[model samples]
Target chain A: MLSVHRNHPWQAFDKLMRNSMNLGRDLDRMFLNPLTRQRDSFAGWPQFNLWTNDDEIIVTAEVPGLEADQIDVDINNNQLTVSATVEAPELAEGESYQRRERFSGSFERTLRLPFAVDQEKSEARYVDGVLEIRLSKPERDKPRKLSVKAG
Target chain B: MNNSTDLKTTNPPSHELQKQESPTPEGAEPTRETRLYRPHVDILDSADKVTLRVNLPGVNEERTDLTLEKNILTIRGHIDPPHYEGFELVYGEYGVGDFERSFQLTNEIDREGIQASVRNGILTVELPKVKQASKQKITVAAG
Candidate 1:
């Protein structure tokens, strides 16, 4: 006998719930955050990526044409914020832009982690225009293995 | 085909920033092929020269390759993906990969005079326009 494909009802319910939540967010953005041409262009500058290990969480952002001193990184507990403003390039007296696509403006983005981090022990590095922040998980937040006694 | 080679971009409509596909493997182990991305660029035109400014974060001078094959100019930058020991990626807004972009040069461009430089992850290339031969000013006094 051919195995019948099982269709779980929960999966459909989960999808429906997610779709409604997303629709709510879309409505909220349309009403609360008015979409402007300027906002659409640079609102999402410097995309980010996050990684986690047993003891630390790593956050990285691509900030091209910026140095370590140009960008700011701040962390409080489980919240991390990265902000920067790109200076506009100067043009010569007779020169003008034929095609401009790069972004130049100030933007700040904040992220909340699953657990709090140790701010004092955290480290940040800027290399090749990429910013990386390693936030160490606090002692109480890290997982601890409890060995079972032999019976 | 998920050949463990090709990559795709995460952001759907971000045309200004670098666009590359993950092609990032599930783990830290290296994949058989490297992912390629196209960096954003600004073109500046002047009376004598045109300048191209390319955004190439995480790229250095040594890892960049600029070539002009006939009229096609190619810019390639190789970068090592950000990796942390024993860490798993939790969130990703962008992918890391090599940057590759190409532009076509016209006959008016002086290919021999073209020059490029990379600094602070930005690459600038200047292409000079070939000078036109001087026009003769004919005198009609004696004619």
Candidate 2:
């Protein structure tokens, strides 16, 4: 998508405000939300993309500094879930950060697929901090082109 | 073709501002310059070294560039826009573009000893601290 760049300070401020609001919710989740107090919050770290075609659904997530082993993708009954933990890098002795903006912790993202998928035909690959997963549509869910005979 | 060996850099957009913004006496100058997004970075100051963790998603090792000149460090990289032949985008929130950011280095860093590596879209730069940068212990002599 193409976006027009505008030199408006208020726009940036608006984005900042929105980010702070998200941070407030994150803080709440970090401090207040226990396991029982389940808030249906969709906010999570590392942005992603989801697309679909007639044959399959694909998901791509940008998660830098993570290995493939650290991520877990699961699908069941048209629901897809991705869970991962990004451990903070160990600091050497006397090490301190002037600024630490990158987030580190566990996150779980659950998505509802548009159609049922064949679990056995799915695959995932991780490269250069991008994780791409392909889930093939089930045979029953595939759209069929019917043949018509005219007399 | 999804080749694992081929290095991938995120797509570079043609929309980057061509000229730096400057003041014009007659108010004839363009109102805006190129928009540059600041990449998130972590600067760790340690006794032995200072490390930087920069997030440059979609940028590969081959497309990344790190330079240190006159106590200033700069990082630049390009990312190719993703294209799937048959798929239509259903949902998206992240924007794609090239990444560029620079940092002024302090005197504590050893200019010759800096090292950088890019892995899994994270650029790690280690700047070893000079001997004098470390905290010095002073000895007191009783007179």
**Top of the candidates by TM-score:** 1
Encode model 1's per-residue lDDT on B1-143: one tens digit a residue. 54212111111234545455533335655443667777877787777888999888889899899999999998988988866878999998888888888889988899889998887788989999887653356778975
* TM-score, every prediction: 0.71, 0.69
- After TM-score superposition, the amount by which residue A89's alpha carbon in candidate 2 deviates from its true location, in angstroms, is 0.7
User: How many clashes show up in model 2?
Assistant: 7
lDDT of 1 by residue, A1-151 (tens): 1222245646766878999977754442332221321222245677889999778888988777777788788888889988887654656656665555676556788898867899988989887777888899878777888899999
Instruction: Report the error of model 1 at residue B137, Å.
Output: 9.2
lDDT of 2 by residue, B18-108 (tens): 1122223365543334333457777777777889998777788898988888988988767677889989999885666667778899888
Residue pairs with colliding backbones in model 1 are: B7-B21, B8-B21
Candidate 2 per-residue lDDT over residues A1-151, each given as its tens digit: 1232355647767888999977754543343223332222224555668899988999888777899999999989688888787655665656665555665556688888888888899999998888898999988778887899898
Q: Model 2 chain A: which ten-residue window has the lowest total lDDT?
A: A32-41
* Two-chain complex of model 1, DockQ on C-alpha atoms against the true structure: 0.28
Model 2's interface RMSD: 12.5
CA lDDT, every model vs. true structure: 0.74, 0.71
